[model samples]
Target chain A: MKKDKIINRRDFIQTGIRTGIGAGLGIIGFGLISRSVEGKTIWQLDPAKCVQCGNCATECVLQASAVKCIHVTDMCGYCDLCSGFFRPGALELTTGAENKLCPTGAIVRTYVEEPYFEYRIIEELCNGCGKCVQNCGAFGNGSLQLQVRQDLCVNCNQCAIARSCPAEAYSRVEPETAYLLKGFEELKITD
Target chain B: MQQSIKHIKERYIHLTTIIIGCCIFLFWLFYNPVHNFTEAVPGLDNRPPRSSSLGSEVIIGEHFTFFGNAPDPSLTGRWPNFRGADFDNIAKDNVELIDSWPATGPEIMWEKDLGEGHAGVAIYEGRVYVLDYDERKERDILRCFSLVDGTELWRRGYSVPVKRNHGMSRTIPAVDGEFVLTMGPRCHVMCCDATSGEFLWGMDLVKDQKAEEPLWYTGQCPIIDNGVAVLAIGGNALLMGIDCTTGEIVWQTPNPDSLRMSHSSVVPMTIAGKKMYVYNALGGLCGVSAEESDKGKILWTIKDFTPNVIVPSPVYVGDNRIFVTAGYGAGSALVQINKSGGSFSARTLQIYKPSEGMASEQQTPLFKDGHVFNIQTKDAGTTRNQFVCCNPDDFRNILWTSSTTERFGLGPYIIADDKFYIMNDEGELTIARFSTSTFEVLDKAQVIEGDDSWAPMAIADGRLIFRDSKKMVCVDMRANE
Candidate 1:
């Protein structure tokens, strides 16, 4: 009777371990599947065709649009006179709000060297206006571009910004190609 | 009574003198000319808005910045100077280029939004350079970029507010191994290091040289020669050469005729073993000595072929012929230069109206294989805007013209890989073979949607670049792609 009881105890221990592992795996898989569905087929911008109009600054379901300037570090010129950082009427190169290119002062510039600099966007400050992108494309390498942050976007059935885009730059892209990255090796050429 | 009368007369005389003094004091207060002055600092005016006049100064050496990484320099065809190294708008690349584009059209390698202008571009080693006017910034900027990828390398500029007069910044930057020279729309001359955005020197042609502003801004593109910036100033000096490195006047040609400035750039030509600088000034056309012995002396000049609006530079053909032409009903003329015993003489050989032969409104004609090809001016009756080819021996001979189906306005044309690339003002670019017997177009494509795509075309390393009033594009013309 004692031997039989010991055998049952071992069997119970093995089943408990197996069940625990299976439940852990099941939870991870379910979380991934749900996340994919939540963020599926979000609105994005085609970097190649975007005209950088100021419409992204407005025409959003949110008071502050989910659009923001994304910098491609590999393609950056690192110019001290960064068009995306300094305002057009800036009297001098400084960190003052009056001299900033971003209306909300979202871009933060850090000096890397005598002629080089690094720019980062404080996402919290960005309103997705696209003014900086226009300036950068005009005078820089276009390293700074506009993007729709899916996390902040509501995935509206009818996008308010797309309805007003003159270039028709906004579209619903697959999740794998969610963002039109500037440094992305291949750019999709469109008509 | 006599004493009282004398005392009253003295009092009356004192009162009259006091009244007269008061009147004189009033006159002095009203007419005194105490001057108040706002003396402008020569090259550093704080760029006020709506500044279209000459001597409206700009801050020189205000900004210099470097961007983008350099490209690998191999088989990189160079358009290092204006109109290529030979001063002719011809590509020196041997890379096999597509004679015709694919159905999707010539693939745009990259595109950049530009401020309003017709500024052309120059490519050297593996970089492209252009002088552009930033309307929002109110400054003239010299931007450098990678030729293969359209990535910006650097920009050097200063603030000088300019209004839209037709357009702004129409001249291209002259780039060499060491320096790049740019002539701003308001006559500000700037030179910077070619590789880095180092400001070497800047000069105001209006303040220092007293050059009269052309009806438009300075359309005369600067050219670099032997480390000197060659400029047709037409100020106190008809022409002047500045040491690019030191910013010193090396030589100056006297403007005895007081010929005003024209929009045409100077062309260097060798006639009878003598190299001369030929310029089409406002009052006349002249050939000046480019020799070290008498570098700035006028070799020969002609006033009969003068046109008030001269845009095309004079072209040298064969041993003794210099062809000159202009638009606005000014027509075209062929001038013959005769050298006898070290003395030079010039005379107009043939003069013809637009309808009679060949005339171009904007771009200089291309002279290739004993034939001259030009898009005829709008005044040429039925042949208006037609790409017409004529034998140089007889400009009047009916050679061939593109059919009425494909007409190009004042856009640019360049010969590359044995094909004629012609762009129209409406932004349609056509590719045609160079033929003397017949006019034929192989393909057509719209490059830019904007109007006034009149900037001259530039090509390097099988990359074709052209611009309209609003934007510029770089296209891949490489073969087997």
Candidate 2:
């Protein structure tokens, strides 16, 4: 009976060790899988497909839409009379509240050269209305585009903005390439 | 009293500590002072309202600004004015444009975005001129670019609050060695130095000339001949010749009948060795004297041969013969001007519907070797929108058609070196031959991927510049090399 009991105890101890090893390995595997899946994907705007219909500003559930205008400095023409900044047919080509195309006054234009003015966007103030983007794409070099900042985004599985987007321009992209900018294509004059 | 004082003193220390903590919390809560958001600086994101109408109160020739610096002049050949260096829409000296495009198609040297319009470009030696409208700033800009790389050289503009009327600018700039003349969509004509972007002179036709804007904005392409810019004003004057150097009005054609202007441009035609400016006005057709002796004098005016609307300029077919066409069921007419007894008399030889004969909508027919080549309008029965060649004598004699397989819609074609460089509305450029009996498309290439490749082709030094609605492209079409 003692021999049998000892045999049973040994069996139990082996089973426990096997169970412990299996659980440990399974935990490690799960940790790797979770790490690979978590925070790796982000919201992206495919600008080529984006129609700039002003939905980016209003569709998001957040009080202030996470979408903001991204200015690609290299693509910008830096015109003294920027189409994105000023309303069409402003009386004088000057910076003023009435003349500004941006509803929230997010873009800041600074003098860079004699005729060139560098435009930078303030993300917090930007409402993603896409009015400036519309004007810029229509008239200027299309440097200004709307993008979803992952830091400000809640990372919803089904984004409200994406659901309402008419162009279906939103997609889950790798964190590295979260924005697609026109005129900044690596390929020169492909079209 | 001592016990009470001792107990009160022990409680006093704890009470004092609580009071101090409360005071610190209150101070932290109310320490920061609040002020309103900074008032937007004056003239920074602040401006007055824009006027709704197009004939802008905004000053003309107010701003002559230089944008990007132009490169050193290297290209020597000149397209000069609207039709190439020569008055005829044909390239001279460079015959190499006849060769077929490479397998990969013509290499697009460069392209730039233009405001939505058919407003085309004019190439002088090394510069490209386009009158572009900035819709946002409410300005009509005269932009100059380098011929080599398409880099913007300089821009001269004036504020004009014009709204989009099916693409704002439509006229092409008339450029020469000394000056460049541009007519804005709102009937404002501007003159500037061709090389320096210097503001030379400005005139508002509505304000100064009493000229009525065309129905769909001006489609009239300006022409400069012998340093004199000839414009079919069609107001109080049927034609006006301005010395491009001084911007001075050299001569004017009287409009006794009060005929309105059409979209047709003034084409220099020589019948019986007499040079005259033939223009198809809204009411009828007139041939104005282009000679220095009697510049701008209406040599002959035909009142009966009139179309409801005329877009394309008349083509010089034979001696004393001109072919005039219009779309919208207006059909085609051949006007033969007989300069007998030192005077001119015009009579319509043949007039027929588009389906019955050779009729064109937007492009003027090419008269070469006694044959007329043009893309027949859709109303043309079997060969609708096909590049067809017909005998000028008999408009219905279709010697050869592009066939159903090779049809194009209202495109532009130019003949160079016995070959035709034809561009379809879908941006397909077909290099064909001027065959007497067949349509031979030697090579076809998609030079541009966009639609509406409608801007008339301009070739200078074997370089061809063309555009659609949005993009302007340049390609080297040198035949020899």
Candidate 3:
């Protein structure tokens, strides 16, 4: 009877420890689900505050930065001699890479009409260099801007780009509505 | 028999799990979150589609951006045009100013960052108007600000791609009660409602008049005379007068000699009871009729006084003398216009090198009380870059100079409240007691910490407006009451 009692106690202790660990895991999983449902914040940068310092390209932890250039077609001037696309003092407004301001040639210029050209950004080729953004703001309508593409973003706990942003343009945003776009302030879409 | 049945059931379950995994993989492959979220509604309904038949390459006064309205300070002051209302850089209003600045320096009323240019300002009532080039927007912006505080009231911009030729936008706005006139770097003239900042009319001198833009952009500031916008257009017409209200070319002096536009501006002078407009054209010196009877008629021309780069406008001294000086070692020339038989003829009296006599590099000398004040050119030998006083009687008589220690480099100076406000290239301001016999700097202070502070200064209502290449500042020169 004494030996049987000792064996039962040992078995009870093992079972209790196993139950406790399982309950703890269950509580953690529930918390994670609730947090996600409540809309966990992801990193974002305000385009208005961004100074186009080229840090979004180099400071990101990923080999290909989540930050990319976004074209706000609504705000574009549709200029033939787009300062953002062509180099300053460009002899001709052509699609030549030598005359292009973009180092990666990510901006595709489409001749929409006479004296009006459309500027589109290729997300994959964009390294978030901000050279185009700087020139566009300097000489054209500020349509070319940098934004963090949430699809490519790994959503790190501490974004490396956010930490190094000189203009303090970076902040955490909701995952569902991820973009911080320009030319939308009048619509009051941004908080 | 029981072991065989259990093993078969387990195999069936494994096959079901594999099928479910494959279905999930297929669903993930087709779904694209980026595509779903960023719904770029690029249809014509969402945005206005840009059409090819919109306009030309350069549009004048195409965009008007309103910042914020400022409270009217109701200040009574006026520095209306390039050289003020009198066509002389002298503020002779009743407002009293301090004789000397405090050790802490003049109280800076306000300051604003402009584009990379040396454009000056025009103060009318309580508003300050400046013609600035926005390099980012690639537009010429005529900005109106509150003189009390540095609040930008409104801005009118037009896109005209101007390369930075020694910086752009080198003209001052001519603001009156009714209209504000601005000439862009490319010789595009815009006239706006002075109070409302409404675009009244625009004329592209290059396109409409075929006026060739000056080498370093249009340095000629526009002037308004009795509601007539006087412009020294030098392509098809040597000089043109536009009706400010109707936007009509009232009179235009035909450019028969094909004189190209120069950096010099037209100065209206009345000599021998005859009113005329004296201009230092790139090719020569000419006087157009400013009278109502024979307006736009070229009366006198001295082809001998032509310089490759003429900057200073013709300074008309008494005794029918007009002093013309130019940089690039062009020296100075004294031209006299004589009226004979209701006809005008110009004669070049004397021409001397900078080292031989009084010559100005940038600004037209201030003639006051029978003495002419000028900052001599760097090529003036002992008087190089020095502020000197000379007699208009002789081109070589330099009575007084600011000395070797005080030199103003291509900067500008103005006379206000019996004091001379001189600025150096580095923006050091010197306030000297206005005296032709002696040079005395009452106080000196650094107003702007930048290079190329060569824009002409404007003062009214005890407020002095000065600028560097990149910034403009206003200081309260009113005496502490």
Candidate 4:
């Protein structure tokens, strides 16, 4: 009777130790599996495909659309009747915020020379609304277009701006080569 | 009976102790859940060493200096500069590369962890040069490595803080025979010893010209021609050519008309037997007379075809035709250049949206045998993006298209041995054998496990160098013995 009791006590101790070990392992396994799921996403953009639709302003989870306007000055006409800067059929051709086609008044116009004027864009104020792009493409040289500024882009899933683009302009670009300019060349220019 | 009672009592005491120990362990495991004491301990994170000093010992080798031996006259396969020998994305002779890669594609010989940058590789004299961001030092680096073993030979760069816009720096280095020229993320031009990696001279175009930096940063790769480093400073000054040997300002393309610099680089062209510099500036596309002392002659300007963004390098196929494309519904255009009386005029032949054909972001279209091949983005009519081929004269009809797997591709196409090598955004290296009818995918492999393998590829002495934002890889595509 005494020997039987001793053997039973030993077995009980062993079982308790085994149960504790199994529980510990279960906790560790759960932690590791959760970590693996978190390592999957790196957001990027494709410049060649981005369509400048107004959804970039509203669809983005952030307060501002990551998509902004970029200007290729080489492609600019430097015209006095600037389509990218002023609203179509504006009452007057002046540098008034209300007369600008861009809803946020992002484009700044400056006198470059006698017949030419330099137009620059303040990208942060741009909402990718395509107002300036529409005006630029229609009237003056098409120098302004909506580009998903990768730096500002959160790289969201189903990029809200891309889905809403009317021209279907948003395409996935290699983030490395994402920025597209209007008239940049690859060769050395000799003066 | 007394002895038995004593033994039972001892057994009960031992059992009680065992149960108490178990309770203590469970309490330790569950108590103070907020602390995570075990994980907070040292030697547990399993991260790579974070010491900033680790990069200092990563010795760039001894081959950075250039002694200028008239580069071998008969050297057939040297990709001497940014795009290639002529700033065109065309390889010299027909090389017979392997038509197909395995399911995962060609074997990756080696890969090294690199800092961020969009700068591509420059291969010359069996060596490879690249510009990359070094986060540890907070500076951009110009690193040269041996093409054979992927070993660093030398690196030269000063500290520049990275601005928070998707990281900084994107210009590729231009490698000529005796010099390597680089444009920093902020439009600073640095001419370095091609072999030694020593800083020769630096010029800040941003401050000198009072020009605003581009949206992302300066991306125009410095151009080296006839011992001069030519750069496009987008201010009132249109273009500037600096003497590579002495770092002196050789000539500045006068901005008498006040044209700003576009993101495009300068392209050298020979039209009607007259050499001219084809530059796309902010105001318009202008062709400056290469032989003129003034260098500011505007040959022709295409104001109507200007798109919002022009990122792709212009590809000049014949003496008379030029192709330009961009994203954002801004389509592709083919221009016909007519030269007479020592001046030229360009007329647009066709303009089609991305739905009709290929649109390029950063890579110049590959022109060969009267056919143009490029990776096109999507548009209104088409739901899919692809690699396409078409006639250069008419951008209208598509000759063929790649597989439609919803995968997007960017950057330049590389040709080797009658085959085209394309790296997609997801890091798949696809080798296609070119025929007029179709792009036959011989093989495809995921060479790197990262995003944005968009830098233009460099191949020299039978090695192919490619990169993503985080790493650069050198693959041996040569035939195995």
Clashing pairs in 2: A95-B43, A95-B44, A95-B45, A95-B46, A96-B44, A96-B45, A96-B46, A97-B45, A97-B46, B96-B479
Per-residue error for B35 in candidate 4, Å, reads 55
User: Candidate 3 on B128-151: residue-level lDDT in tens?
Assistant: 999998899888999999888878
Q: Flag regions of model 2 displaced more than 4 Å.
A: A1-191, B1-55, B68-72, B479-481
Every model's DockQ, to 2 decimals? Answer: 0.01, 0.15, 0.04, 0.02
Compute each candidate's TM-score over C-alphas.
0.64, 0.63, 0.64, 0.62
Q: Give lDDT tens digits, candidate 1, residues B317-403.
A: 665788788875577888889899997989888888777888876898887777788888866767888999987777776488897
lDDT of each: 0.82, 0.79, 0.84, 0.67
Worst 10 residues of 2 chain A by lDDT: A87-96
Q: Residue B341 of candidate 2: its Cα lDDT? A: 85
Evaluated at residue B361, the lDDT of candidate 2 is 77
Query: B1-481 in candidate 4: lDDT tens per residue?
Result: 9999999999999999998998999999888976732222222213233221212322222123333323333434667666787776666644445666644556677787887656788888766777777788766677777666666777777666555333355777888858998887766677887866676787666566666566456667778878888777767567777888899887776665556655577888877666777776655566666665555455666654565456676778785877877654566777777888856788877777766766665677888888888777534245344787887756677777776763455645777777888888778887778676886887777788887677788777667888887788887776642
* Model 2 lDDT per residue over B388-419, tens place: 99888888778889989998877788877778
RMSD of 4: 22.2
Q: Evaluate residue B70 in candidate 3 and report its C-alpha lDDT on the 0 to 100 scale.
A: 64
C-alpha displacement of B391 in model 2, angstroms? 1.7
Error of 1 at B398 (Å): 3.5
Q: After superposition, how far is residue B125 of candidate 4 from its true place, in Å?
A: 1.4
User: In terms of TM-score, how similar is model 1 to the real structure?
Assistant: 0.64
